[model samples]
Target chain A: MTTRRTRLSPEERRTQLLDLGAHLFATRSVEEISIDVLAEEAGVSRGLLYHYFGNKSDFREAVIRHAVEDLVAQTAPPAEGEPVERLLASLGVYVDYVLANLTLYRSLVRAAAGGTDEVLALYEEGRAALTDRIFREDAQGEILVDTPRTRLVVRGWSAMTEEMVLSWAEDPAGMTREELLGVLALSLPALVELTP
Target chain B: MTTRRTRLSPEERRTQLLDLGAHLFATRSVEEISIDVLAEEAGVSRGLLYHYFGNKSDFREAVIRHAVEDLVAQTAPPAEGEPVERLLASLGVYVDYVLANLTLYRSLVRAAAGGTDEVLALYEEGRAALTDRIFREDAQGEILVDTPRTRLVVRGWSAMTEEMVLSWAEDPAGMTREELLGVLALSLPALVELTP
Candidate 1:
């Protein structure tokens, strides 16, 4: 038993724990989940679990951090294409990421709703990055205004993306990905290169 | 006690209960709130509370519905105006509505995040309404988009509105009503007609 447990590397073990924790947190509330259950289910000893994560909140944070990192990595801006094509590629990345991580994504939202400052901060940071990206891309053209206008456009785009992801996650069959992306592509001029 | 109670009609009493309930749910998890506390705080007997709202779930739904209705009512669309101007005016209505119903709005989000199918359905319905409104006023020739393109713009604009509202609800200071609306007005051309 000990040898079987040790077979996996520490990083591998941590990844396993995060996967298990994300599932539990998504299925059950944070207040309802405990360390004992997590350890038992993951086939690791309680001490080992604690050693890896100090407590439930720590575990929750770790899981969230991992999920956010994965999401950021997946949604990284696309390169070497038309600016709008790159934008659409990023949206595609987001759609896939959200679909794969629906449970964890929803839990992140739950965490935000519950006033988890760390989660809220991470969400803000992600949004700020997206906001900054839009300004950077639209900087040269007179189409883009000051930082404040960029912020609003970013805000609108962010809201629209989340709403779409949530819906698509819930009902994948109802809306085809192609249909959705086509609409988004056509709408680009309105959202991106708005004439003054 | 009877005289005091009689002064406030049944509708008034129900509204009072909802207001108190919204406050409790917003600050804490939905599971944490108790009907007893809600009844006492609302200055009504537990029996009377039950009479109006049969159980915890029912009461929770009632509170959410009440909040949704108030939000919708506060932002009634303008009677007549130019399409883009009308859209912006309606957006202003939404921002004002969110500001006025801040607490209840937060509570609605919390209750919606409960992961219950009923709550999820309510959230979807509300979201769809917002989408419908955006799509409805999407200027055809003015924006110059085919069906596919129109859909994307609609989704993008809708998404932005939701994001701004959520952020403003969480922290009004980060972005003010004027700042948000102004930025939105600038970005409006991206999805609407720039010229009057």
Candidate 2:
């Protein structure tokens, strides 16, 4: 296997390792990818791999964390846009990202289902960030009360969006992309209104 | 270990095994409960356990199937309530079931996250049944177009309810059960209205 032979800072090296891990995870099952293979692929010593990740599971978590961060970054609204425009832009980006990275997305789903605490935390963090972004963008500088009920409603909407996107991903022919986005947008006002 | 010594019909014995499995699963991780121990506890041979469930994963799937069926049976609205009353009643039963069976509920969630096809299928089946019940009860014999968009909305609502209920189970003090039911009820009309 070809290996990178470049001197780099710790941060750069960590990013390199995470990128390699994410690439491997996208194509192979977590159980199928071994640390030795990862090290070989990255041209790093096994000790260096462990130095950064501690273990295979930790390495896998880092990869998932990276993917989640990537998703949030990709889907977050632009710095300046109308509330409706930003919402549509975010949703469109989300659908596009999931479609482009279906395999990696499935791996994340599988990891979450496995109920590993670290993985679940990462998934939740990503979910919370996305939800916050949606709310923040929709607020558009308006002072809306952020009560517990409102929090739950946003979370509920986020969960629903995830389920809808996942289902749509699995069966794209079932509904047009525009229809999915339209349905999600249409439901939000009522969902928000229900928040007590 | 205390083992039962009663002779049971095949169906009865299957129920017994499932009950024991559920009991074990409630307190132990799926990996912790082995076939040998389960057979020992159930007063059956290992081969007999295999005869009933091809393997440990299969046995776990069976337990999940049983739980899903139980949830469906417990939460399906009665045949004689008004539409709104039946919807609220079904939601109440669903919340009660999740709250009462938190461990089994967590196991089901974990299994779904784990990306096991059988477990996911069982979850989807349960979700679909619950969503269909909600729609059917809400329709009150009125014929509605069951298009893909409508199906997506119901599924989205079901997913939201699940996330809300799961969150509520984790921290009941965050939202009262009544409030949870109320928020869910209020959202349905808008969701259904958008279901073209």
TM-scores, each model vs. reference = 0.71, 0.83
Error of 1 at B110 (Å): 3.7
- Please name the candidate that would achieve the greatest lDDT relative to the true structure: 2
What's the CA error at residue A111 for candidate 1, in Å? 4.0
lDDT digits (tens) for residues A142-191 of candidate 1: 33555544455556666776765676567643457765665454554565
lDDT of 2 at A108: 80
List the candidate 1 regions with Cα displacement exceeding 4 Å. A1-42, A78-82, A125-146, A169-179, A182-189, A192-196, B1-42, B45-47, B81-85, B114-117, B129-156, B166-196
TM-score of chain B of each: 0.72, 0.83
Alpha-carbon deviation at A78 in model 2, angstroms: 1.6
What CAPRI grade goes to candidate 2?
A: medium
Chain B alone, TM-score, model 1: 0.72
In order, candidate lDDTs are 0.65, 0.76
What tens digits encode model 2's per-residue C-alpha lDDT throughout A5-100?
Answer: 878999998988887887786677655665788878767799988999898887777878888998998887777866666677788899899888
DockQ per candidate: 0.30, 0.52
Cα lDDT tens digits, model 1, B70-183, are: 665556567676666766787798887766666556556655664576766776577666656555655454433335434444555665766667676666544566666765
* Every prediction: chain A TM-score: 0.76, 0.83
